[model samples]
Target: MKIGVVTFPGTLDDRDAARAVRLAGGEAVSLWHADTNLHKVDAVVLPGGFSYGDYLRCGAIAAQAPVMESIIKAAKGGLPVLGICNGFQVLVESHLLPGGLIRNEHQHFICRDQKLIVESNTTAWTNQFSLNEEITIPLKNGEGGYIATDETLKRLEGEGLITFRYKEVNPNGSMNDIAGLRNERGNVVGLMPHPEHAVEPGFGPDTKIAMRSGVDGLKFFTSVINSLVNA
Candidate 1:
C-alpha cells in the first residue's frame, strides 16, 4: 500500500513517519501542505511536530492547509487516516475527531515513554491490539491534554470510540486518560503519542532487552495493511 505523509512547515517528524511507513512494508509518499492533491495514496499519516509553530493555537493553522482539505474528504470516504501529536490537534481543529488538546495541566512540556492501553480494536489502525492490551510508546508534547464537554465525553466513552487510554500514569490531564480516539466510522484516528518514534527495534524506548526493544508501533501500520488485504 502507498501511504502519504503530509508535511507542513514546522512539521518535525514527517520524515520519520515516512520511514516508519517504509519499514512497515508500505510505500511512503511525501505530500506537501501547499498541494491540493494527495497523489492517490491508499492511506495518510499526519506526523507529529509544531505546524505553523503552533501559532494562534496548536494545529489551528495547519488544519486549514490545502492538503488537509483533501485529507478530510478522503478520510470521510473511508480512506484510513492516522494523526499523531500536532496531527491530532489538526484533526480536532478540522473537526475530523472530537475534543481539543490543550496545554498540559501542569503547564509544562512533558516527554517520556508512556504506557497506553489499547481500549478499542474496532479502528482501522488498532486491529492488532486486544482490547485493554498495554503497550508503551514515546510521548512528547507541550499541549497534549485532551478535553471535551461532559456530554461529549460521556458519548465517546459510551460509544467505545476511545482508542487508547493512559496506563500506569496519566502524563497529561487528559480526561479519562484518553491517549487516542477514532472517528465513528473507525477509519480516521487521532493520537497524542509518538508511535513513529517507537517503530525501530533497537532505537525505540528502553524495554526488556538491551539494545533490542521490539517495535510495538509497527502493529498499527501493519494492521492497516492487513485490513486492506482482508477487505
Candidate 2:
C-alpha cells in the first residue's frame, strides 16, 4: 500500500514519516501541501512540523493548504488519516476532529519520551495495540495542550473517541491527559506524540526488547498497512 506523507513548508518530520512507512512494508508517497491530488495513496500521514513557522497558530496556516482540503474530504469518506504532533494541530484547525491544541500551560516547548496508553483500539491506525497498553514515544512541541469545552469532552469520552492518554505525568496540560483521539468512524487519528520517530532500531525508545528497542511505534504504521490490505 502507498501511504502519502504530506510535507508543508517548514515541515521537519516528513522524511521520518515517509521512512516509517517504508519500514512498515508500505510505499511512501510524498505529497505537497499545495497539491490537491492525493496520488491515489491508500492512507495519509500529516507529520509533525512547524508549518508556516506557526505564525498565527500551530497548524492554523497550513490547515488552509489545498492538500488539507483533500485530506479532510478523503478522511470524511473513511480514508485513514493519522496526524502526529503539529499535524494534530492541523487536524483540529481543519475541524476534521474536535477541540484545539493550545500552548503548554507552563509556556515552554517540551521535548521528551512520553508514555501513552492505548485506550481505543478500534482506530485503523491503532488496532495493533491492546487496550490500556502503554508505550513510550518521542513527544516534542511548543503548543501541545489539548482543550475542549466540558460538553465536548464528555461527548468524546461518552463516545469512546479518546484513543490514547498520557500514562506518565501530563506533558502539556491536555484535558484528561489525552495524547491522542480518533474520529467516530475510527478512520482518523490525531495524536501529539511522535510515533514516526521510533520505527527503527538503535534510534527508538528503549524497551524490554532491547536498549534502543522501543519499536512500539512501528506497530502503528504497520497496523494501518495491515488494515488497508485486509480491507
Candidate 3:
C-alpha cells in the first residue's frame, strides 16, 4: 500500500510520518500542501506541524490550502484520512471532523508521553488495536483541547465515533479525555498525538515494548495497509 504524507509549509513531522509508513512496509509518497493530486496513494496522513506558522489558528490557515480542497472531497467519498496534532486541527477546520480544538485549559504548551485507550477499533486507522487497549504515544501541543457542542458530543458518543481516549490523565483537558475521534463513516480520523514518533524501535514511549523495541505506533500504519488489502 502507498500512503501519502502531506507536507504543508512549516510542517515539522512529514518526514517522520513518511518514515513510519516505510517502516510499516508501505511506500511513502510525498504530498505537497499546494498540490491537489494525491498521486494515487491508498491513504493519507496529515502530519503534525505549525502550518502557516499557526498565524490565524493552529490549522485554520492550512485548512484553506489547495490540497485540502481535494482532500475534503476525497474524504467524503470514503478515502482514508488520518490527521495528527496540528493536522487534527486542520481536519476540524476543514469540517472533515466535528468539534474544535482550543487552547489547553492551563494555557501552556504540553509535551509528554501520553497513555491512550483504544476506544473504538472499527475505524480504518485503529483496527489493529483491541477495544479498551492502552498504548502510549507522544503528545505535544498548545491548543489541543477538544470541544464540541453538547449535541455533537452526545451524537459522537452515541454513535461510537470516539476512537481514542486519554488514559490515566487527560493531557490537555479534551472533553471526556478524547484523545482522538473518527468520522461517521469511520474513514477519517483526527487525533492530537504524535504516533509517528513511536513507530521505530528504541525511540518510542517508555512502555514494555517501547522500552525493549520501539514499535507501538507501527500498528497504526499497518492497520491502514491491512484495511486496504481487505477492501
TM-score of each: 0.97, 0.98, 0.97
Residue 40 of candidate 1: its Cα lDDT? 93
User: Lowest-scoring 10 consecutive residues by lDDT in candidate 2?
Assistant: 207-216
Residue 166's C-alpha lDDT in candidate 1? 94
Q: Write model 2 residue lDDT over 1-231, tens digit each, in one string.
A: 999999999899999999999999999999999999999999999999999899898999999999998999999999999999989999999998899999998999999988888999888998899999889899999899999999999999999999999986898899999998999999999999999999887787887667438687998898899899889
Cα distance off (Å), candidate 3, residue 143: 0.7
What is the lDDT for 129 in model 1? 79
Candidate 1 on 88-136: residue-level lDDT in tens?
9999999999999999999999999998999899888999878888788
- Give candidate 2 regions above 4 Å deviation: none
Error of 2 at 167 (Å): 1.0
Q: Give the per-residue lDDT digits (tens) of candidate 3, residues 42-157.
A: 89999998999999888999999999999899999989999999999999999999999999999999999988899989888999988898888899999999999999999999
